[model samples]
Target: MKKIFISILILLSLAIASIVPFFKSVVIEDGKTGKSLAFFDAKQGSEFSIEYIHSIHKTPVREIYQVHNEEILQTEMRFQEFGVGMPSGADEGEVFAQKGENYILSNMKRTFPSLDIRIGQIIANHTLLLKGHEYPFSGLSEKGSWVSIKVDNLNIWQRLIGGKKLG
Candidate 1:
């Protein structure tokens, strides 16, 4: 009986250790409650974009980022109109241009270990564009709330009970 119990424990440990990493994901969570909103496997250099309509400007806006070394790096942003929070021009080494009706800021190397985004209550319509798919902010989280996005390494336990994944 003792040997059998030891064997079972060893197997369980091995299984947990192996199974945990398989579900590791980059997760987005609600800041107020720490509830997970969504997750996805983001490989190095994998690109994604956040699109939303500016509440005050009522113009379309998109921010592009890339995943690298467990962090998200801002690459560029495009917007239809310049508003209160919009950048009038780019800094040194950054490219700013107007393409059609949209102004673009590109060639940025800003890195974020974690990002906080406030969900727009109505007109913002925050959306996540990843790997040719779209995730609506309304489905991922509640409006008018703050969300934290980061690459979190969840163990086997958290993965087993994780939130929605970006399919």
Candidate 2:
């Protein structure tokens, strides 16, 4: 009876441990605007989308990015310039848009020189929500034009075990 009880406890603990990481959340911010673009509940291989807007030649431009595994896999840009002052050669009924893969990282790096964003690493700072609780992160990284805050996978075990008390 004692051995059976111990085995059951071990299995239960393992089950809980495995389930904990999925509840973690990620928060992404646009440093230039000082606004949060997305709050995502993410796992190691999960995907999510973020949107940004800019202006060019008095035209409003919007871009949506698809992020997966800490990498931006696709992007779509749309230019909003519908009115009497539209460019002379522009297509009146057509939307100006462009999309491709592996473009965001380089663009972001060039645009936000202070942030120094990389392709594979997650950015620090901003709020991380895990299992309905909020934990503000403060780590080393220059605030630039964009930033992403995600639960550190390397510290998942610590987060899962210590999160309850911290939260």
Candidate 3:
């Protein structure tokens, strides 16, 4: 009986070891562009932040928000709506760029053009309000460059083994 129990325990250990990698989170980063892709499991009601780096100055910009209903709203609207001043619908990129400049001038009291505004534009373009528990998020830059974010769901083996923590 003792030998049989030990064999069973070893088999269980091996099974768990083989399944742990599937539950682990995956992250990819771009060395030249400072872009990244991250995939992880997040419980409902948890909050997370996405960080963007300035291409020219190498400054870090962080956008923090809660994950409500498994969605993260983008900082700016991607397209212009047909309303009020925009009867013909304007490009969101141009509109947001101007807004960024105006916001810096009004709030930061800066006269010269700041890269921070461009950073905001990038965040707005790439960062999307994520939806669904097992959905992927792709963050884009002002130049329309993007990175992938994929969340994994635990499989039966992982669930039976109590699952692993996502990184």
Candidate 4:
């Protein structure tokens, strides 16, 4: 009886260990429908970014983020020129600099549980950067729709039925 109990405990531990990897994912879901548009496997400290062209300035801007504490933390930003909604200088606990033509803001501590973004109908050219690959927003969802980006732990069934991976 003792040996049988030990074997059962060991098997249970192995089952849990195998399911953990399926839990960590970066989920891009439709805000209105609550359907996952795309999901990709990621570790706890992985980083991803979104790059888009400023609609008015027509310059480029990139926002870098890191997965931490089961949330997405906006860590840095690179942009060209100052315009509406553009940061002129670093606020408290932030570092600002300029590298060539682009201005960079680093060491930012903004945290968001999820981000709701509206894809542009014609412009903005939103792109997701992960693992040195680029995924255009247009390909993830339709134009002018809202998407919520968040880090979610999906169960095995959810992960199996989830949307296409970013890769």
The best candidate by lDDT is 4
Per-residue lDDT for 63 in model 4?
98
The true-versus-predicted C-alpha distance at residue 107 of model 2, in Å, is: 16
Error of 4 at 100 (Å): 0.3
Candidate 4 lDDT over 1-167, as tens digits, reads 99999999999988786577557889999899989889888787789999988888989999999888779999999999899989999989999999999999999989999988888777698889988999988898998889999999887766777787775
- In model 2, residue pairs whose N, Cα or C atoms come closer than 3 Å (at least 3 residues apart or on different chains), thus clashing, are none
Candidate 3, run of 10 with poorest lDDT: 105-114
Clashing pairs in 3: 71-130, 72-129, 72-130, 126-140
- For candidate 1, lDDT tens digit of each residue in 1-167? 99999999999989778666654357899888888877887777878899999989898899999887778899999998887989999988999999999899999899999889898898999998988898987788778889888876776656656688675
lDDT for each residue of candidate 2 in 4-81, tens digit (9 for 90 to 100): 999999999897876564444444444454344434445544433222222223434333333345444323334444
Rank the candidate models, highest lDDT first: 4, 1, 2, 3
Candidate topping TM-score: 1
TM-score of each: 0.87, 0.33, 0.30, 0.86
Q: CA lDDT of each candidate?
A: 0.85, 0.37, 0.36, 0.88
Residue 89, candidate 1: how far off, in angstroms?
1.3
Q: How high is the lDDT of residue 61 in model 4? A: 93
Give lDDT: candidate 3, residue 50.
47
Higher-ranked by TM-score: 1 or 2? 1
Where is model 4 more than 4 Å wrong at Cα?
1-22
| Ordered list by TM-score, greatest first | 1, 4, 2, 3
